[model samples]
Target: YSLSVAYQPSDDLNLYGRYATGYRSGGFNGEMFGSNPFFEEKVNSWELGVKSNLLDGRVRANASVYGYVWEDIQTAKIETDNGTATSGLVNAGEADRWGGELELMGAVSDSMVVGFNYSYINGDFEEFPDLCGVDPTIPCLDGTANAVRSNSPGNQYSAFTDITLARLGNGEISAFINVAYSEATPENALWSNLVANDVFPRENPAQIMDQRTLVDAQIAWRDIAIGDGMLTVTLWGKNLLDDDYPNYSINFGALNFITEQYGDPATYGVDFTYEF
Candidate 1:
């Protein structure tokens, strides 16, 4: 797909808009067993919005909304394992999803910047019914015995501020910090990959709304000269709060043969590079 942004000047306002086209292969809601493959979900989208550089670019803001349609969307389908009701992938039927967003970026001073952004999304199947032996209220996924990870949220948000710390010692050092947070989204909107609250039956699935908070920082020294180039060292870390959380769920997938290796220990790494 192609995406582009343009700004023009009118007597009363600064006009801004974005034009783009994109396509995605139908996301597989369940797994494909043996040699039998399934169909995919596809979408076509279009959108437009505007922004204003009010107060001489000191205060800038923008807003936009978009809509899309999916054809023959993949929905809940069934699979059998060893002549038994096992896990598998199926079309979610057909559907449509649409949403809109708003944002504002303002500069209160040469050293300070503030911003805010929000979005709302809504997606649903036009003809999604329960598969045989499955409940519409449960999410049916592949693997993990029975996991109910399904339909996700369409709402999102953000707000932030940044300050450029004044340079220090020969006016060469710079430092900055950022903070962000958001709402939890179910795997999608179905509360399950195929059906709401239903699991794939290879693993144990839980009803969870995935959301979390994060804070990060950086302190570095730069410009110390080596024999041939500048030497710079940076100390950085993520999820620094050491908050315990699930990074992702395993649904057997293509790696189902490796179930015995599921609960591996956490990881830590270190590196040193010299540019010459």
Candidate 2:
């Protein structure tokens, strides 16, 4: 079920609110773990937001705050027994989340524009208990609510600015830059702990992906006369700073080593197109 409301107090401003409920169907983890499946998960969400244009249409902004609760969340893990490993899913208990976002765009002039966006979220498991390992004597089951939810980033931000430099030969030349940042994130319990202080002293004691920033740039010429059509040309570079950040990492306890994947390095490309 869901509900929503909207109000416009002036020609330049609008307010809105919403409440919604959703469900996610759980399923088996992998063929290695047959016949067993995780339970479904449900969530209830609420949001309040506003949109406005200020400074005589030169600036526009949108912002929202939201909260949600998750029930019977499905979680997955891998287990090994006697040199064979299998993946399985289970119904972890409840969790709650809250977040907010703001987006702003401004026209510094008719020839230049800038935009920015930011988001923050905090989520955690409220109740969960599961086996820590294959050994029954290890006493892995414990009732605890302190586990940090997987894949939940606490903060993220991005911004972009574009400017039209000049007009020549019936075409406009523009340049733009984009930047993005993300806070460190918690790692999965499975691989994160295998290479902790007890094992790999060089590795992080708490499994986490370090904060990273990425930048991109582009220059383009548009509406150039080409025979009977218009032509556009663009030169672009991605990951311009050549940041070498880990895209993924895992510590295999059984193997006694950690593996990591790195993001793409700086790359450049050019594109040309003709429009009829």
Candidate 3:
């Protein structure tokens, strides 16, 4: 395990940093491990940040940036046998990731508080070849020089806002709404090996995956007695609009391809619990 810490010297001016490392396991694909073997992957990540409370503790803000490098990134290797993806995880050579985040908070009044957050991320295989084309008719991944994996996205961003209200006597009721946004991203960094003879329509979505904006809301009621015990419940819903956008794409080379992706469908659920 990686050991690191963050230190804040003051309430008005705060600073912090951290260092961490993680491992990715190596594994064989049941589809093709019989003929091919694969290897494992690893990564090292580091980050730093600063936070501040301004306007006499009414306003608060924080910002942070991070970087990471991976050794022997596990990659999927495909073979000509039925064009099925069967190779195990192989060292993907190397890869890296870096990003930053900013957030702000404010106390509008004694009864209400508001906050906002934003984040951006950029990741690249750095060494993967762009053998995949831009058209929609590309057949299965060509075993040719064009064949590559590591389709991670290059740019991603998100924004969110939240609000909280004071509670009531026996039980408190607070409502919140949060909206988030993200830039389009590549489905994968490597050429798909789904079907051997299949030429993927496009290595990724015909274009960058579509950007998306999601809105969610929640209402929580807590600290109430139910019968002989205390009980609480939350009514929550996500993607309330049920916006239809592509969440992912598949390109098996020319043999098979799915250009459009199906995003999450809208749903609402309730959580209820009682303590004795």
Instruction: Highest lDDT: give the candidate number.
Output: 2
Arrange candidates, best lDDT first.
Answer: 2, 3, 1
lDDT of each: 0.51, 0.78, 0.64
Give the runs in model 1 whose Cα sits over 4 Å from its true position.
1-7, 11-22, 25-32, 74-89, 134-152, 169-171, 188-206, 221-232, 250-276
* TM per candidate: 0.63, 0.88, 0.74
Residue 242 displacement (Å), model 1:
3.7
Instruction: Pick the TM-score winner.
Output: 2
RMSD of 3: 5.5
| Each model's Cα RMSD | 7.3, 4.1, 5.5
Per-residue CA lDDT of model 1 for 1-276, tens digit only, reads: 656666666643555545454444543333444545556556667677776777877887787888777655544333443333345455555556678888888888886788877888776556553433245456534232222224444666666666555554532343434444545643422322232233432232332445655555554555656677666555555555554544334333323321221122333333233567
lDDT of 2 at 92: 73
